[model samples]
Target: MSFFFAALCRTLSPRKEEDVAEDYLSRDAELKVKSQTALHNSHDSVKLIKFADDTTLIGLISNNDESAYRREVDRLVSWCSGNNLELNAQKTVEMIVDFRKSTVPPPPPSVMDSPITSVESFRFLGTTITQDLKWEPTISSLIKKAQQRMYFLRQLRKAKLPAQMLVQFYTAIIESILTSSITVWFAGATVRDKQRLQRIVRSAEEVIGRSLPSLQDLVDSAFYGRANSLTCAGGKSPAEVANTACSHADALNVFRHRCNGKKTCELNSPVFEQDPCSDTFKYMETSYSCVPATHRVVCEHSMAYLNCAAGKVIKVLGADFGRRDHTTCAFRRQKSEVEKIDCTNDAPFVAEKCDGKNTCELRASQAVVGDSCSNTSLYLEYAYICTDA
Candidate 1:
């Protein structure tokens, strides 16, 4: 049996706006120091995650045993007490996920002798997460918000706003709401949910009297590495710049070769074989996404081989040399050892060494990527894509 547990822990209230403005940098430094100072002792089955003012403790209970989970909670309370930070138990909550066919409910978790509330869902860092991990509620909230703002779009159209102005308004207001966390939920959205979201775009297009880009088009361009726009405009005046839109034929090829499947890239300056328009100031504008990738996991002390077709080369998306979850390489390991779920060290050098190769071998060892979690059997996990050589 397994139990997914999450606890929301709060600390002291933030300073006033005026106080923050008086010494913003100092205030930020103080917060950073405070975060570093109030450290949570290492635990086997629990991980502490902090974002600005919120602290969340997440644990995976194996074999229906919650000893480590409960210990971590008590440790958090003790740490906060030692730090003189008030942990508002009234506002703290616990959410559990258990999917056994027949099982007794676990006792509710408490903080400071107060019974922490159990919720079906809670908004964490702007994302509404339910016990079942469904996206319906979050999507519904986004749709409602977008629809309410659609009223303002209609009012603008009635006022005889220009089509360009209407499109900009839709992009800034309604579209932003619809796509607030598109990457997180779009892939998991139901067919009906996707159609509902697309309907918002269609309504905006109708109001603007021109065909607006569809939600799919945006997702493909932004998340699937398809370039929606690439141009080089040059001339002396605004009209000249608007009229001149010439780009080298090999621009697309250059971009793809350098950044097709990488997570992040930097092109200090565009290097073209020959500038299409060299007479005037010609600046480049490009928008593309990193393509999707397949990932593999290699247990500690093992070796991994990544390969692609003869004509393709490896393009690393991301690589980490530690455990992020309790289950990945947890075979025969102690519960405490497997519970170090937050241990992760990014290995970007893996990309530097493996990218552009047709086949690559990786050694998952502390010698290659220094140990990120002591006493824990870490593993190598990486995601990559195969691109034309």
Candidate 2:
């Protein structure tokens, strides 16, 4: 293809653009393409010809009508040097040698960064990424990132009070070296382990995959009414899961302070607590909502939440929306079937009675337990990040 294109282009020019392009372009790729173009500002008589090498040449000859074909012929004659345009086969070798000898690639241009006028100090490129964001680990951005993480955790807490050990969240990694001093500052977290950190990372990945379902998954799961059940932050026991989540959150806060960043205060909110809400339920098969990834925990029955009494979800303790009736339950009731809800209400659904017909069509598989021992898929993604800094 290279030979073909070059040959084609060569036949179009007495002196191919490739031969003069480097010199005119200063060996810059952007300039190379630009220099090779026949960018005429206005219509004019121009010399356009093909060469034996199949290279094309286009050049301004004359704009005047009188000089039309004459100017083009003159340009070609000049390209031929002393030789005539109608050259016989005998002089072809001599003409080729002359053209090759005259052609040489242009040198690359010299580019320098902003000049250093002062010898004493230099203005370095700002280490701060003032532009976009990265989905992976990096050194500089910490607090901005931590707060982003905190926002996500809070959202999980709002949706799933007793979020499972593997509830997912966005993550970022910082070098431990930057935070080693900070971990020591926290007396309790001195015995950190690398393997433990890896486990935490795996947990975080599961959480993200669940929350943000891809476009294809969203279409297949939502529009098609397919059962892609995945529970993130919901688990067999809320108490055990909350404890594990807190440890990871605490480790991240420690990592930040060591980097001379803001010290995140201890959180006593239900977000970091075991038994965060008044009620508990054994999760059946949990499917995602809204998007393919937003987790929707499906309890087996409309039985009152362990935390509810008098037909109302208890309020003294934080009330979560799970474990309610299939229709007209507290959460759904607040919507009035069509009205807008100012605050989230407890939402539950009643499944058609189970007569051993296996009517429960929840896709339950990953890490299952509880009365759901027979139905497996009760699993949630864990989203997290750690920095050595």
Candidate 3:
């Protein structure tokens, strides 16, 4: 019976595999057909690029005509409806990259009867691009993201993880985020911006308990070394050399291959659908040069009471909710005794409760953030950064 069952399974496996392949092919063909039809239905002047479900439509207008842009948006909305794909209005934004000086203001474009919000800076494919083509926003975002990952690095260090393994984790988690689209944007970055990025690397080096070369130094060495047929002479291993080679080649090749001649192009990170480098450690970075957009920055100091002001949202960047030697935002039970709650992981909860509101009052209590520890007194401690809604 066991022999007969084994033989039966073998006989059925090929047919099942063929059926699965046929199903996948049919679904792929159907998706392609729908996507093509959507593109075909769009205005002739509008350019569309579809990757999976993400679609971007680009339209060129002279002297702010905007008629062609609106028509394309309306057509796209209709197409999506026909194909059962609902257009997400909240995610839809319009950015006009106009370099030419004009006496009159440009007309605003609308989609699906709603006015599309115009943004000075918007994130596309992990890179923050501004209309005026400055790298400051991207750099700021990168630093902010890297700082969060540094928390994990600190945790690992405290746990006394192996140095080699910590380095691997840093490269995989922290470094990857910092360099996601470096190739696209690194050239346009200002000196100060580069210095700011290097500072983060320096912090990483400190965390790993080893000194590594600055990002600029690495880039320069990679570029110069590749230009000259020279091997990087050091105690460096083959893996290090290969990593540097891939990083060097990636930036130059991406710029030369993708953005060299194009007047206007969408430079997406993860440049190719497939891995371009054979080494598992190597990945693509992307950024673009564009015109600067108009924005305002407001700075304020928050002491015991924190307010987000009007038309702004509060984002808690980092927080340490515990008792300290100093008296800051103290929660007192008796005159001598103080109560505190460590609610580090309750960031999301606080955000959910307080974000989008004009003001919020926080009470450090078990009810608010649950009792993390008993007997030892504690207080709520946090730091927040606010941004315009």
Candidate 4:
């Protein structure tokens, strides 16, 4: 009995239910009355309640399996065997397995949960109607609705629409529709029964894959109705926007998340790397930061320590007292080439008495008068600092 209500709720409430019937079916009061009677009879006493845009399917399941949340849904079929339960094979899915498979990449929003009202419509008598009035949502029901819309969206792309338009259409629609990548596999089987529909979906997928358009680029065409200073062409609803991008809410969420990580993003030439974001793991040993000069190492405090192999700072020098020459040509040098007659006419047989800003003193050593120098260019060349000592 409970299982019957579950199916019953789906059929009775069209608001929560999405259109599953892609087929252009008939509309007439006679068929609807008959169908409604048949469906109501099968479900027994199940009361349905409605909200503004949402409908709640409230029915008690008599089956212990359902109340226990067991795996089997077949018990309902046993109860309604005599009626037309018209269960499409494509609609059903292994919920747990599917969810698990879907977690890696976020699942696309299910069509069954569509905030949109009415899908596959029907007409009973003079009134035009839609199927949302007929169904309840469970994961199973949603999958089926998704499949149907998947087919419809594909058809739009394949129409004589221009390629650019098609690209825009799929970008917005598919992004909203394709919540998970794996949904494609299910989509394939959804319309396998109809070759035409299958072709539509395949084409949509092809368009979606090749273009990879996001919903970010669109201009609102409709004016603010005839109320204000709005004189424009035909007015279209939000839905009429056709290939409008993903829902604003979802797009904003993703945008905010990426924005929060702005510092981590390697944008422009300025990059802020986290500690463990290295490749060869060699630099991970000690703290050395890469400087912009030649393959040189700089400490975290923007001080150059040692030149790097690749001319770009590879290793980050740590707090140790390491030193590096300035980034550019600091001191200049002149190259000396051996000239034949240079020393022959030179007065340098005697070491020229050195006089500069600083003077050098001769030490009592066994060598020439080169022992001690003040500023000590030549003498300091051999002088070992305490650091080196």
TM-scores of the candidates are 0.57, 0.15, 0.46, 0.19
Alpha-carbon shift of residue 153 in model 4 (angstroms): 10
In candidate 2, stretches whose alpha carbon ends up further than 4 angstroms from where it belongs are: 1-140, 170-389
lDDT of 4 by residue, 170-280 (tens): 545543443222222232222332333234345565754554422122110111112212222136443333322212223322222222212121121111122221211
lDDT of 3 by residue, 1-389 (tens): 00000000001134444655687787774322233253552455566655555566667665546567667667777677555455656567766666665534454555556666766766666677677778798888888988999999999999999988888888888787777777677767888988899898989999999876666544433121222113543665555445444334345454444333234333444544344344424433334433222111111112234467678776543332343332434344453434442212232444556666666656555455565455545555444555687
Candidate 3 global TM-score: 0.46
Write the number of the candidate with greater lDDT, choosing between 2 and 4: 4
Instruction: Output the worst ten-in-a-row residue range by lDDT, candidate 2.
Output: 1-10
Please, what are the lDDT tens digits per residue for candidate 1 over residues 44-92? 6788887776778888888888888888888888777655466788778
What alpha-carbon RMSD in Å does predicted model 2 have with respect to the real structure?
27.5
Where model 4 places Cα greater than 4 Å from the true spot, the runs are 4-50, 63-165, 173-198, 205-389
Q: 251-285 in candidate 2: lDDT tens per residue?
A: 22222221111121122223223332233221222
Query: Which predicted model would earn the best TM-score?
Result: 1
The alpha-carbon RMSD values of the candidates against the true structure, listed in the order shown, are 13.3, 27.5, 25.4, 28.6
Candidate with the larger lDDT of 1 and 3 = 1
| lDDT accuracy of residue 91 in candidate 3 | 66
Candidate 2 accuracy as TM-score: 0.15
